[model samples]
Target: MLPEVPTEGRIPFLDLTIPIHWENHAILMFGIWFVLVPFAIMVVRFGKGKPTTYGIPRGTPKWAFPEVCWALHFYGLYTAILLALAGAGFAMLLTGGFSGSLHAWFGVGTIGLGVLQIISAQFRGSHGGRKAPTSDPDDRTTWGGDHFDMTPQRWWFEAWHKTAGYFALFLAGGAVATGLSQFWVLGIAIALAVVVIGGLITAVVLQGRGYNHDTYLSVYGTHPDHPFNRRRFAQMLEEKDRKP
Candidate 1:
């Protein structure tokens, strides 16, 4: 039987009438975003680099396809799990509606953006070029006899998916900061420190090995028009020779 305080004037810092249930929600949110999401991203980022450990040459685009597919599959599964946890947390918040509060709405927005990210992934298929094909069962290549065609729709989906991910991270940080503006000083500090350290490590690893999507594109092809596409390299070379 919590006190019936109306959602309107219950800003976490200003109101200072925190209930146990709200505190529970804050802890749940923190754990899901700070710990779980980052860990999943780290695993996908770093795990993709480990194909070299299994004898696949580093920076070889064709060899990396299977690893990239597996990484996306793992991330998609992780996103679904995070959505479920976020849904449960939001359900608890709805018991006493979070009307007119930045923290609540920001949290809701993060969840929505995350859902969009998952949907975007469903459309991520590799635009294929006519290259040497392998018979590996693990390779789920999107390329076929399309004559070096680049699917703009798939590229747009990937771009939006990445944009939504960045927004989700920003909203999660804002929600956590506002939610704990005036309470649990020590716990919040420790939790933030952990998150920052983990983030730095992930950044270093991603920078060292390279971002997965960009690396794949660089090795594969930007599009049929771009000079980087393998199909165009020979054409560019011939044009260069003819110029002088």
Candidate 2:
């Protein structure tokens, strides 16, 4: 059995007496990883505007519906990162530096991955497409952007950012599990299970209903001349030709 924490006093650990606000820490971290972060991910995953050639003109105001999804995702994750740092800092301060425990290590790993996600997004290159202000819809020559051309920079950014974000969440699951093992909160534990199951069900339903559109097709459109589409089409033809 775990040792009981005394009221109005520090909790005893090996060679250390640490001040811990268990309730506050649990609430803050639970809301961030379980509630806010998942909401942001779900919104971006299923809330993209339907794939259309003219969808979301480049200069469309940021407050618009589909555009707002991106805003929520961008700002929501930023908020989570900041709050996570604050929570972790407070805990570390009270604990007098790292505890070198499993929970502590998991939290550190989760936060490190979260910070890297933000830094990677900053270098995602430019947005250039048919609807971009710098491009003319009638003239493909003006569509000269890293994204429009599927340049190496943009491709690598998407590859890393998308994959890393999910991996960070996986680490967060580990952190939450380990944290609860150390200081179990029944409410938070129940909420975590409900949220995970609900999120999976929601994703399956939305994906089956065709809500998970391709990022390129949703933002840029299905124009045959789009660089990415053209390349994909060429590759498909080559694969077909190689078949018996």
Candidate 2: where are CA atoms >4 Å away? 4-19
Pairing residues by index, what is the TM-score of model 2?
A: 0.91
RMSD values for the candidates in order, in angstroms, are: 8.2, 3.7
**Which ten residues in a row are the worst by lDDT in model 2?**
1-10
* Candidate 2 per-residue C-alpha lDDT over 1-244 given as tens digits, one digit per residue, 9 for 90 to 100: 1354322333335445654668678889989988888888988899888977655676777778678889999999999999999999867766556878787888999899889989999888988887788888778788879887899999999899888888888888988888888788898889898999998999999999999888788888887878999999999999999999
Stretch of 10 with least lDDT, candidate 1: 49-58
The residue-by-residue lDDT of candidate 1 on 1-244, one tens digit each, is 1234233223343544433455555666777777767666655555543222113333446326545644554565466457545654554445445544676677778777777776676677643432325323244253342222435665577578667776887888887886666344457668887888878986887777656544344334444443235545777888999996
Q: After superposition, how far is residue 60 of candidate 1 from its true place, in Å?
A: 16
Instruction: Tell me how candidate 2 scores on lDDT.
Output: 0.83
lDDT of each: 0.56, 0.83
**Which whole-number lDDT from 0 to 100 does residue 243 have in model 2?**
100
